[model samples]
Target chain A: MRICIMGGCGHFHTALKPDIELAGVCLTGEETPGFSFLINRFGKVPVFPSYEEMLKECMPDLVVIDGLFGHHADMAVCALERGIHVYCEKPMAINEEQYKRLKNAYKASNAQIAAMLTSRYEPCFYTLYKRVRERTIGNIKLINAQKSYIFGERPQFYAHPEQYGNTFMWVGIHSVDLILWLTNSSIVDSHYFPSGKNSFGFEGLDESAVAILKLQNGVLATVTVDFLRDEDADTHGDDRIRVVGDKGILEVKDERLYLFKDGEEQELELSDAPDIFLDFIENLDDKGKRLADDEAAFLSTEAVVNITGV
Target chain B: MRICIMGGCGHFHTALKPDIELAGVCLTGEETPGFSFLINRFGKVPVFPSYEEMLKECMPDLVVIDGLFGHHADMAVCALERGIHVYCEKPMAINEEQYKRLKNAYKASNAQIAAMLTSRYEPCFYTLYKRVRERTIGNIKLINAQKSYIFGERPQFYAHPEQYGNTFMWVGIHSVDLILWLTNSSIVDSHYFPSGKNSFGFEGLDESAVAILKLQNGVLATVTVDFLRDEDADTHGDDRIRVVGDKGILEVKDERLYLFKDGEEQELELSDAPDIFLDFIENLDDKGKRLADDEAAFLSTEAVVNITGV
Candidate 1:
């Protein structure tokens, strides 16, 4: 299982390097600096200057894309067209057109494509998902998903909406993915409210965004994302989801899953979460079920892009 | 002030009888049963057969309307027309036409009116409101207000949507009131989703509803109300409100207020909440500020009714 890395600036892809190594997947080549140092500081593997060169020389079985948001679709499409399994960072693409191109390329190949939607792999959320699927909360009627992050230092690309994507597409898509996944529903309608007043002078950037989504299953959901968390707060981000169902309510907040059912509140004991990178690699052999495959990525990315108008 | 009571079925007015009495207001006459029992449980006050009869004979300075939802507007209008201050149960009217008539009648009189929007008087909510007013959370960007209640026994009137208001207008209005009051904004645009699956066979009654409101202040808010709580639950209702601002987040859950600001979480010490009934009496004498006054009640009811299309 030879894997080549391209554009390793994204934190998600960078974080997956160690896990991929631990899974015994071979890192054939790299196209980004410092990534090679991370794989092997002794320089046993050659680091290529570009993805095309790496594909031509290394002929890796898999390609991991961790580039600017705007470039992900092109990179994924290229890899898929070459019959290489691709693990792309979320969102899978910047817009529906790019997503369509990638989807077309994937249809032409036998490789498996996955996106880094890690929320489903978190222990608390995984527990909540299982409870929901088991009908612990009965039929879900409404969902309120929130994502709040500290406005930390950003790369120059973030200042350009064309490269970084809008706040909802970049950050809110996680909640969108969760809504679709947990509810087993598709978006029927959506509206977006974006604000830039508190962007701290980041031009063309929305500091906060609220997306109201109506799902086909007759469920109403709202996803609110903001980069306004205090940098020194107890957590880097405040991620929470509340699911209201006919029988009861379920909420995941501060890394704990709480279920209110039958007039009693109880916290579920969550098992250790499966590693997304490892699971993606393992599913390559069996073609078995994966949490966030290409289809999930496409749906979430499309819905978010449509809502945010990005 | 001499006060008369009409249709004492609503628990709000029943609960306030003692407070009105302590405020030295005389109960000149009554129009409904059980109300006289609540006020004296004896034959201390004369019980009239109807509101008009009580009004004609007593000529009371104030009228407390604890009638069915459909009758609130007419009762308020009747008292207001006679220059009698009125305290009516919530959902001041079941529909827009009734609300409009009440508003017009209120405009044509000097009498002050109030509604049973008791959420603003809860100790925890009072603290949360004060903090928001103090800008403790910065400018409000998004609000998620939730009301979940146990599916308790209901009267026959609840089976008719024409009599009792829809779920959003009746239960979700408290959240709407809070949104308008806390954000200091009026709703500019709104949408509602109503479902009746869990209404316990109550025809034409919605057991759950979700309302998405866009406020004039550019704030986005969602209010979800459901009567699906377990009857034996620790609390009869699960009421929660989450306010997201640029600098921090404020949440009131389980009768406690939590603030997340500057990267830290803390529980706020709340002051004792003033009694709504007593405050209304005091404000009548002083012409001072009162929470959930006629204007607040009118705005909230109108917004909910408009959103629910009831």
Candidate 2:
């Protein structure tokens, strides 16, 4: 499958490009750090400084819009309108207004669009979701998750409101999406309070925020996002979820999933993030069980903004 | 220190009475399966059919109200009116109105009363609180806790609303009190929802309820309460908490405190639950930090009723 990569030299492209063959590039050099690396590997295959130029020249089957987070909706809209499938990273947009626009655009285009909430595609997350659905854990009462990373200096684009929007939109958006997909529930109500001052290049945005999400199924979840962790933290960052149910307790951390039911600890090895991503790629056109699509992406982003006012 | 035990004999009293040399008793033979065990040990101290009679007869220096969950405020008011100090078991009253009455009574009498929110008094819980205070955990943003047990048929008294108001009051109360005390902050706002189906016991009383608690200091906490486990589950009646902070994560489960900071898990042995009765007994002069007293107990109990309702 031929694919064009927007924001070609950025973090996602640097990691995902070698895994998936790329047909074209849209690197402005001003947007990302790894432009030289992309040029070295791909031999300058249709390099363009803008999305419109890339589309007109390459016209690839799929467009991977892994650019600055806040731009996903607009880029995805362009790709979908041109009858190309789109794989976009999360926080489809910063707020509900932008998310609604993306939703409408996706509907109007009637093309395949997926969000890279890859965590939902993981084996452990999917297993836990199935368990909750089957009532294997009984009635869930609470869900608590944390996604913390050590922030040093972010890319210049992250400092722009037009690019990253807010810390909640840029980083917190992952947890918001995963919780809903994992639980198969929608957030009924939510409240967020920003904590820890941010010294980043942005203004009026929190470096750390805590959101209380109340799911429609009566599950209450707390998601904490912090861009301030000590450097040299463990690989893959740190992610944890503690789900309390009437009959059991489930905790996932690192790559191990632990379920405490019948008063015993049962440990299982979880598939890593890459495995989850590969599954999505393989099942792209199955049409029976699609991965997280624009609608899921839109709702999750709307939930995040509703809670954090990004 | 002189003490009077009301509605004596349960696991709570059995564990505590020997620790705090019981000076008097006002048993009603209505408490628990352990009542006969207490009768075997204590050997007929004093018996009263009603709480009012017990208050009038055992006018001791300290009142240890270990009755049913719903009777706390009435018993507290009786002790306070007669200028007696109180250290009562949790869900200090059925509702906020009753808690207000007890608070006013204690204020008028100038008595030192403390709620037996013994989890706060537990050495592990206290250590966790102190660690957070000492910045060992840094700025806390997320707190998740659970307490569940294999539910059994309650005594006939439970069918009477006059005895046990709700399951959230009877058992879930502990989690509410602990979240407030451990965070050292008042709950600013909260949203609680029923778990779709009652797993613990009956209607009108939540067998299990989920609460998204917002602390005054911007910490987000989610707590769950349930009494629906298998009859033979080997769990320790359920206790766990995961506190995520800027620096690291601290988790406590089954008397083992695990600190995961700086990228490794450190196991620490925790001491047992505090001898609450001993603390209240030793502080009979209205001086020491009493449990379920006038001020603090009211807030804790109010939280319980707010989640469960009277």
Candidate 3:
């Protein structure tokens, strides 16, 4: 089963590299960051100049897309058209039309698909996920989460939501995926409130926003997503989430799991988390049951691109 | 100067006990829990059998309304009509009509008033408040705060929204006060999303809810308020807040102030927090300058009472 890579946009495809080398890999038409890493190590831009050419020759079992944000859906749909599995960076689609097309192709083909929602596989989140499933905190009543990133040097594509999409879809989707994965709840209703003031001079960039989600099982959650972190911030991203339950509370921050139980703040040992990319490879045939809902990634992206801001 | 006590529903009025004993307190019409405390101590259900009688005789310099949650407004209004100061337990008014009357009376009088918004005076929050004023976390971007309470035995009034009010206003009011007080920003637009489901057993009880506040200075905040805490939980209430700004981040919880700056989490030495009741007593002449916005409290309660639920 051949695995193929496409596009040079982001480093998400790097997750597939070690596995790609170990199992033998094929390069599709685009010159991606992964391509250079492979070329500098193995010598040569390693041929196949296009997606159609790669598909005709390689007939790869999977396609990993790390392309322009807007191009992910069409690329995934192209793979799905031939029943190839896709391990694409979020989101698989940027618009309702694009999502619908990808959904159609995915349903019609016998293919496995995944959005790169890797946060849930982090050791801290994984430990929390196990504890949540174990009812460590009891019935979840509310959740408050944050994902903040610095506005350090963006690729020119970011200036256009049509190409890069807004930070709500680009960055916020990770939390959207993890919260759903951990809570095992569906979003009955969600609203994205964008702060339109601070865009750092990019007229189309949505620098800050919040997502309010009402889960079907009576859980209320608010996700604060922003690219407003100051350059002086020590880290490029700040991720934190606190889950409050009827029994107690649990928090995941700075690679640590904190349990606030019986008024005690205990930092619990983290659970070992599986590499998402390796897990995807190992469970290729299990289909949708294995991955954080790729469709959620698509749906959220579609919802935010045409955001009804408040 | 005299401090007269009114009815007692909750134990918050206990904060005034020492001062009341030292400063010579008076008791007005109606039997309150405080009346029992004073009577049990002084060997009598002391004096006045009516508010008017107490006003005429005691001419109390201030009134502390710790009556039925619904009667707070009328109680405050009565004192305001006579230019007497009031330190009322929250929702100075429950409905718009009540708030309008309270506002009218307040505007026409020289009375100093404060809501029992005591959480902002906690050492952790007070410390964060100082740093915010000092511009420690420069240019606020967003805020996430929580106030969770256990559904311990509630008063008979809990079954009546008309009397007890929803938890959104009753409990969430604390966070509204603190978030606004710390940010030093006015609420530009606000919304209350009540998860009108988990009401334990009382149909009228708002067991869980979230308040989304858009501040005037581009601060986005969400307040999660609930009465879904399990009885076995350690504390009666779990209060927490995280303020993120362009410069750094700060959190207040568990009686400690945590600052996340330059990727380092530091538990900072807390600043001295003035006793809220003591501060109010000392600064009665300062009017609205000292207390967390009493109007924000009233406005929030008023807005939520007539909530347009989603």
Candidate 4:
């Protein structure tokens, strides 16, 4: 089956392409860029100048859209309208209007679609979601999470509002999706405050934004998404979630889960994301079951839009 | 030294009076009437019918003000004007004007004074503070902290708008103070959102509020303070702070400090809380070196008042 991958010129493709067979990778950039070196190292794969050209030539069975967060909805809609399954990335769009259009397209097409909230596929979150469902922590009441980084210039999204929108919508939405998915809750009220702006000799966008989400069950969560720190410290990237329930507290940070059970603490080993895309390929083959579903990803992105007032 | 302790007929006195040489204690039996066991246990400490009567009679050395968060500032000022020192509970007042008055009175008087942000005195926070300063976590870049509980009965102060002009000032300020002190950074910018009325049905009181603070030198922090979760959970009662720095991320929740270092995670033994009054007592003897100087505490309170827009 021929596969056409959009947004192939980006770093995501640099990681995702090796996991699956790509009949053709499309980019707005002409001249196949650095893929020749990749082809020399791996194997030969065809490259197309644009997504439209690739779609026409390959007639691909699946179209994976790995474009910027703000462009995913439109590209996914285009793919769905053509009756092609789509694997889009998180923060599917800038606002609810885009999400609404995407939802309409999905309904109209009955297309197999998925979103890449790769963090959900992480072992730590997967286990927490399971335990919370099994009532291991007993009636989850609150979820507090953080996804912060000293984003350097390497991720060009921070420098392009047209691509990342804001730190909250770009990287922060991962925690937003993971928390809601883990607790099986939906946001009822939400707000965001942009902290450090672009004046610090930093690149494009607000340096960071703080968001508060009140879930339907009255569980309150505050998530801070930032791009203002220095990335010299590897263990210092703040990616964590803490759920407070009637019985105890369940926290997953970095690569471990701490269960505050009966006044004692216990640690459990969790995945450290050695091969993040491996799960995506497995799920794509399974029609993306047990991974972050399209609806869940959409709601999380919707929360980001609401908070950022985008 | 003589003393006048308010809320004298209640459980607080039961916890505090053992360490206090209370010459007088004031009680207002307005709700369910307070217990008289204090008079039975420590007969030497007179039980006054009211604050006025106690003030007219005892003229004590210190006013141990344990009133609600809203009223403590006003009562502390009144005590200070009469040349009495004040040792009050968290959130000395509910607005900047009142906080200014409290600060002014402390300055005008020749008496020793302090506000009880007792969580700062908690062993876990002390350990975390020392360790961070000692470079256990290296130079900090981000902090996420919280203190919340299941909303109890509408606080007496909530009913009196003259006192608690804002809910964020009443409850959220402590979490604000904690994050500021833990990171040891000054504010650059902040934004907050209130979560409607208290879920426990406190009139005019916000159920919760969340804020994002940008610290000088580019570190960012977020804090959530609420009274909207079950208090039984281990993560539900005390304050929690996570500081991500250049070397490591240190998390202090209640009485435990969880440290992430060199690809391994472990809990550290924290310190013990002494009589918070001892700090003021030492400062009184030296006229310097207080745990939290009035100016510093006032600055934190001002940051909170400004963020909540009270």
Candidate 5:
């Protein structure tokens, strides 16, 4: 099967680096960092001049869509209409209208799709998921997650809400996706609080934001995201989640899982993580059982769009 | 100064274990833990028959009120009306009506008052506050706190909402007061979520709860509280707070302050912390310069009542 990458604007394309073979590559006509990453890793693969031209001529069996945030939905729709599988970056669409169009196309297509919600595929989180599935922490009642990112260099597209979407979709979507995936619950109630007070000179960015969501499965969850970490911090992102169950507690911090149970705190060993790109490709054979499958992508994006309304 | 303690139910009476003269003591017609604590620590102080008698006959200059959750407000009011300074366990009031009554009595009296918000007086938190006040972390942008406690032994009053109040007022108020004290910001918007599904056989208790508040200073803050911590865990309470500013981050986890700044994570030395009860006593002469003064207690309790409505 031929695999093509559209818009080297996010790490989604890197999923192709480990195992899959790339048919073609498309850049957003700028030297975005993601393109540099592709160049550094794959070293000058085939390039497509424009996204539309590639969709018309180089339509491969699958298209990994990244690039500017607003353009992702239309690109996915274009690929899906041709019965092509689409694996896109976070926030499948910037608004409900775009999401609706993509949804209609996805329904009619004889293809599989997914978002690059790779957190579920990380070794630490994967292990945590496995333990929770094993009832190590029984009956998740409350969950709190935090994602802190350094305000590193950004592409020019981020200055426009139309191009980059809002910060909730860009940064906060990760936690929302993780929580929804773990709980497997529908949002019954929610409150969205965003402040663009310290926007770090970006017009559409909220440097600090938080949301509280009550799910149908008797879970109260919270997400706090910020882009105010010092740029020179150790890692680009600091992620944490604490799940409190009636029986035990599980926490993940800095890519490590800490379990508090049996009256002792233990750092559990990580499970082997599968390649994200391979996971998506394998989902074609095992449709509903895929990790972070189509439903998760759509639901998480829809939730973010509803929360941010951008 | 003559100091008396009323209603031995919480740890507030323990403050008298050090450097203070206990003029008298009163218990709420039961062998509550506070009375046992006074007996074990001070070998029994001057015992009064009832709270009213303590106010009228003993008439100590200051009173430390800690008893049934709902009874704290009226006890404080009684003491404040007699011009007796008060250092009470949180929250000062459970409902707005009770808070209003306490406020009136406090306004009419010349006595000083404070809550046993000993967290701000602990070495770890006191150092963080001092450094934040010194602008070590720059402008505060967002904050999140977690308080997890065991569903251990409870007094008889906890079985009723009218006597115990809700979990937010009982447990979540600690973090609310801490956030408000640190940011010095009034809440402009807020949302509270509470669930009593697994209340550990208590009627009014919300085993899991969360609240999000947007402060007037453009800071977004959140509080998550749970009575689901495993009963056999290391400590009865596991508390944490993360303060994020534009320039840096300050976090306190399990009584240790972790600072993330200058591209490094450092644990700073803790400063000497003063006794909370003695702080209020000294504030009688120092006036508004107390650590957590009258406004802090009333504002924190008022916020809790508004959020929980119990």
Candidate 6:
């Protein structure tokens, strides 16, 4: 399958490049120096100066979007309207209106849509999902999802909250997707707390945020996201989820899954899961079960946008 | 000082009995079998039939209240009005009216008052507090406090939400006090998600709760409290507090303190801190600095009550 890459600037496409071959490329006109060289090291794909040129020239089966968050809706809508499947990076869009546009476009097309929600593909999370389904823990009553990322050097877009979306919508949507996917529930109510007090002098950027949500299954969940992790830590991100159920508690911390049941702690062996990019590619033909489909993507983005008011 | 133990039914005072001698006892008429024999093993203190009898007979200088949650305010007010110091168990009052009455009573008297907020006395938390004061994690931006208790056999009071406060106010107040005490900030806005879904067949008892709070210093904090822990776990309670600041993050878990700073993980050595009960006894005469004073107690309780809308 021919895959056209749009906005070859962010690392999302570069990370997925190993799993899928790129047929064409389009710049978002905001690429940094040497961005094309960084993305197309093999120099095998034709680099188009505009997305329209690339779409018409490549006529690719799938379009992977890694553009500016504010421009995602336009890119996604353009691709979906052409009946091309889309694999867009997270924050799917900057606001609800843009998300709605993407959703409407997907409804009108025969093509499938998915977002790069990597948490859904994590081995630890996959293990937790399996155990919860097996009732290792009884009915979940509470969930605490935490995501912390090191604020490494960033591009100019991060300085503008309006363009990049707030911290919760930008980074916290991963946890939102994980919670919904693992619990098989939808959000009933949510409250957000966003702060730019410790943005390290970055104006208009929220450095930290917390979202408390009530799920339809009567489970209370809180998602906390921040960019305050130490850059030299053992991991780039401290991702953890604690699920409290009637019978036991399950936790995924430090890339390991643990089940505290019957007053004893046991580490559950994590099983390997297919890569998200591979799953997306396989779904193109067989249309088998995908971790995050168009509906899941839309619902996660919508819940985050509504909670963070982004 | 002559300390009077009221409602000698629970183990809160019995656990502290080794730290101080009891002069008088007053039961709330809900004592379990051989309660007096268990508390007053030496049979040295006078077992009064009523609180009035104990107060008039013993004329104690300090009153330690472990009564029902519903009667805490009246007992506290009675002690405060007589110029007697009071050390009461947590959820100082079940609701705002009772808390306000206690606040007014404390203001109207010179007597000191403190609550058994044991989280403040934890050694690991003390270490985290000292490091945070030294700017180890820089300015605090976010805090995620968690408390999980094993719901073992309970008294009948827990079955009635009116007699005993709901889960958030009953248990989560410890995290609230810790947040305020460590950060030295007051709550600005708060929201609570309380669920009785997993009460394990107990009616009116909230098995889990989450509170999202915005502090006056622009810090976003969330506190999750639940009674769904495995009873046979290594610890009776799983208490943790993760503080994310501009520079790094500090966490207290498993009775140990960990600082993730400068891209490296370090286990902090916990320093011994004065016990809550001992501190209260020492502060009685000196009127010295106390970790949880009358105002701190009132503020913590007020913040919790307002947030939980109890």
Candidate 5 regions exceeding 4 Å error are A18-21, A34-46, B18-23, B29-34, B40-49
How much is the lDDT of residue A97 in candidate 3? 80
Task: Give lDDT tens digits, candidate 4, residues B1-310.
Answer: 5677875311244234555567787754422134455455756678777776787788987877766555677778888888887776556666778888988887898876666666667788878888888998787767787876655444365655565556566666666777777667788777676665544445666666677777786777778776645444445466678787667778886568988765567899877755566676557666457656555556666777788777
Model 1 stretches astray by more than 4 angstroms: A9-11, A14-50, A196-198, B9-11, B19-45, B196-198
What are the Cα lDDT values of the candidates?
0.78, 0.68, 0.71, 0.68, 0.84, 0.82
TM-score, candidate number 6: 0.95
Residue pairs that clash (backbone atoms under 3 angstroms), model 4 = A150-A229
Worst 10-residue lDDT window, candidate 2 chain A: A8-17
Candidate number achieving the greatest lDDT relative to the actual structure: 5
Ranking by lDDT: 5, 6, 1, 3, 4, 2
By DockQ thresholds, what CAPRI class is model 3? Answer: acceptable
Query: Which pairs clash in model 5?
Result: none
| Native-referenced DockQ of model 6 | 0.84
TM-score of 1: 0.89
Could you tell me how far off, in angstroms, the CA of residue B268 lies in candidate 1 after the best superposition? Answer: 1.5
Of 4 and 5, the candidate ahead on TM-score is: 5
Write down the C-alpha DockQ for each prediction.
0.45, 0.29, 0.39, 0.26, 0.76, 0.84
Give the Å error, residue B95, model 6.
Answer: 1.5
User: Model 1, A173-258: lDDT tens per residue?
Assistant: 88999999998889887777776543667777877777677788878777778887777887778899989887888988888999
Highest-scoring model, DockQ: 6
Candidate 3 Cα outliers beyond 4 Å, as residue runs: A19-35, A42-57, A229-236, A262-265, A288-310, B11-35, B38-57, B230-234, B293-310
Docking class of 1: acceptable
**What CAPRI grade goes to candidate 2?**
acceptable
